[model samples]
Target: MAVNLPLPIPENLTAVAGIELGHAEAGIRKADRKDLLVMKLAPTATVAGVFTKNRFCAAPVQLCKEHLAGLRPGAPIRALVVNTGNANAGTGESGLAKAKETCAALADLLGCAPTQILPFSTGVILEPLPVDRLVAGLPKAISNLKTDNWHNAALSIMTTDTQPKAASSKVTINGQTITLTGISKGAGMIKPNMATMLGFLATDAKVAQPVLDRLVKDVADRSFNCITIDGDTSTNDSFIVIATGTAAVEVNAIDTPEYKALFAAVQALAQALAQMIVRDGEGATKFITVTVEEGRNVEECRKIAYSIAHSPLVKTAFFASDPNLGRILAAIGYAGVDDLDVTQLNLYLDDVWVAKNGGRNPDYQEADGQRVMKQSEITIRVRLGRGDAVSTIWTCDLSHEYVTINADYRS
Candidate 1:
């Protein structure tokens, strides 16, 4: 049995009515269980996605890219096939063929073009996918697709994840309301090159593919791209959004207040789901939020934030709940950003100021710092004393359990 992680569904998903979602127990990796999910989009749905930059990306990532490449401006994807327990990465040409076959199977079931179907997989690496298992599971998943199965769909994507992640939000535009729901899976290998994990956000709102594509990229940058777990990015990381246009109201650009609100709702949903991934990070006990402010630019701030997030010393210190300010400071010093000034730096733990001007604060107390560390969630704020730029990043603590889980993962 796998160790269960805290998987909670985010509120604000009940606003959309036309979108139907569901999952089936395919018994792909485990016997007598459901591990495959099928998502159907209403006819003529528009889709937008971001995929991993890893050269060794999984077969599904390649398949998704091919599907999205064929998408027109207004047409929507027909279906999505996702499975857990085998990444299907690095299996060479056979993996590619399996991915294409999976898409073809889904297309055949939905009576749509193969290029209109997308597939994603996450699990052990380098193993050839049990294509028979997935093929056998397709009919049940398609037959069982429904509107209220978001929870089941969320759980079907889990691999080593201890939790099922979901988020939802609603926005009103042109006197018409739209509902958005999302599900994601990730834990162990979670440093996103293009995307950090497997994410799917869907809405009944009608929007053009161009607008959806732009919005997905913007939101993904601020959410999925801002998180870290083990510092190793997966070959399977990808995020996708689908629009069914069931609401009957069409919007062209994100200029109006209503459109901005819609964008905010989507961004919130994505960020909430992304944070959930980190909170349930494999073997994670504490959640740390790193905020870098006063940098010369957003890129510089992100550099500082990611450096601290991916550092083993910083993560382990978080696990121990030790206020090891030195490790954080050191990480900032080596963040590889241009025009950094260490002399004018300031650091804070939660609301308590710890370091100032490259040294310990005169009023800093070890006991006070320890008090802050006792919480399962913590915030580290850094002021570079340069410009007004800011960036926020999330990560989980490093622990021996994380190593143990991965060391014996294949066994």
Candidate 2:
């Protein structure tokens, strides 16, 4: 059971023009399950991506970076190959060889250069990818490609996610309506400094490669990078954006109205996907948002927000619906802000003021805190009475099911 998360409604997903997706049942780690996904892009599509900062990133991640760098001005990405059940990380030379071979195989079938194909993998780390199974499954995925397969594509890339994560939106740019659709998969190991997760977004509006590169980083910083689960970064985190120049709209300048609308729509979709990941977190019962305001800088505010979000004590209190203000205060105090003034800080759970001036509020009531804590979703707001900086992080409450899920993950 996935806490309060609901299965995504398939009818709500809009298909992006110039993109086709398909899935196949590959026995990579399990038999008779859809574990492989292939996404085909139009030849005019330009792509950009952000990857995990973890030094032990998967072999596919390394290959994706290399391929993206080798892309020529006129040669755009043609295909994306994804597999679940084996992460293909920490397998040394063989893992790199397998990842490359997969790309070569995909490119051969699609009649494009190997660098035009991007390969992605997610599952257990430190495991060798079953290349034979993946290669054999490619033809079926390629043969079944269709423009309206976003729903199944979301399901195919999932590892432990209880439900598929997908979002879509349409915006008018230059008197033309452009469609944007995206899907993400993750359940745990989700502190992204790029998640053990994969996100793919595609838009039909025309965009330059350099602009796409900058847009991906900026959107990710405001979306995927603002979430945490268990405070562990994965070895296979990847978020990719594709612009298929199929629409009549062209966004060549970043300072134009078209760019702002496109950026806002994409960022909102990404944030929705990111929030879904936390809501479906393994053994999570409550979705939590930690907001830190009035700091000297955004970085310091983010530090304090994450400090509170990643605290096991605070998470446990959230799980139990216990108003343990001391734990939250402790996390904020040790958040490495040397100049923080305890007396000038305030804490609130939803609309109830729980703490003021480094202690409990005189008018605070336990019942009020309990009422907000009992909800499936809650927000923690902290005021620092400093500058105007603010930061918000989305997280989930820790529970025993989290331990159980990871303890027997391999079995």
Candidate 3:
């Protein structure tokens, strides 16, 4: 079961204008399941994205980057094709060919150049994608393309997710209302540097390509990059933003108030989706948030936060509801901040101040820590009496089910 997360309601997922989605039962790995998705965009839409930083990035990621670089004023990405159940990574040149072939097939059907299409894949890494089945399903996906298919689109890209992750909201900027809808998927092999997740946000706002490009990165850092599942980054991680110029509001610069308003909406939706991944983390029974504050810089704070969030010992302690508070202090000490002053550190679990100035608080009791640890959701606050910087990372406790899931994944 996924911690405290609830299933997404389909009717509540509003569709962004100028984008149509369709899904098909490709049966790439499983029978009678949605394994293919197609997102058709308007000709006026502009696209931007941030991909995984892993050196062994998947073939589709490399192809998507190439297609994005080829964007120009007259030519824009017309469609995006996604497949689940096979990552299309580590097949060397053959994998690259298969990815391109998938795009070419979809492009032919859409009457657009192959370069105008972006392809994405997820699931069993190193295994060759069942491209034949995926290609055969494109017609079915295209035949059903509808603007209100966001719900089905979310379900098509899922792998280990217990439920489809999707959200929608409307923001008014200068009297013009912009609708943003997004979907994401991931349950394990998630970490920073794109977070091993696939996220796509589409808005009915007019945004210049350059500005949209920068906005995706900014939203990703504050959202997806602030989460970790197993401290492992997948090779196919990607977060893309699509702006269809159907709304009256036009944004071409980053310094305007309209830009800030748009950014807030995108960031909020992205964070909600990102946190869902952690909440549904493989074998996760507890959702944990680690916030590091009072650091000399944001980088150091994030480092400390990630260190504690990624500590298996600390996570296991939380899973067992054991008040093993020292594990957290140890994680912060070796967080690569070589000059960090341990004497100035503090730790807290919810409202219980467990440590004061790097030592166990005299007034603290083990029962108080246990009480917080037993909760379904927890927050671990770390204070470094250094400066005024803070960063928070979301994660989930490690459990026996996580090991079993991975061990039997290929079977």
* Candidate that scores best on TM-score: 3
How many clashes does the backbone of model 3 have?
A: 0
lDDT per residue as tens, model 3, 227-320: 9989999999999999999999999999999999999999999999999999999999999999999999999999999999899999899989
Global lDDT of each candidate: 0.83, 0.92, 0.94
Candidate with the larger lDDT of 1 and 3: 3
Which candidate gets the maximum lDDT versus the true structure?
Answer: 3
Off by over 4 Å in 1: 1-18, 73-75
Q: Write the per-residue lDDT of candidate 1 for residues 268-380, one digit (tens) a residue.
A: 99998888888878788888899999988999999999999999998898789887779999999899975677879999999899998989999999888889887888899
List candidate 2 stretches off by more than 4 Å. Answer: none
C-alpha lDDT (0 to 100) for residue 228 of candidate 3 = 98
**Model 2, C-alpha of 177: deviation from truth (Å):** 0.5
lDDT tens digits by residue: candidate 2, 1-411: 665667878888998989999999989999988899999999989999999999998999999999999998767889999999999999899999999999999999999988899999999999889999999999999989999999999999989888899989999877899999999999899896967678999999999888899899999999999999899999999999999999998988788898899899899999989988999899999999999999999999999999999999999999999987789999999999999998999999999999998789999999999999999999999999999999999999999999999998999
Ranking by TM-score: 3, 2, 1
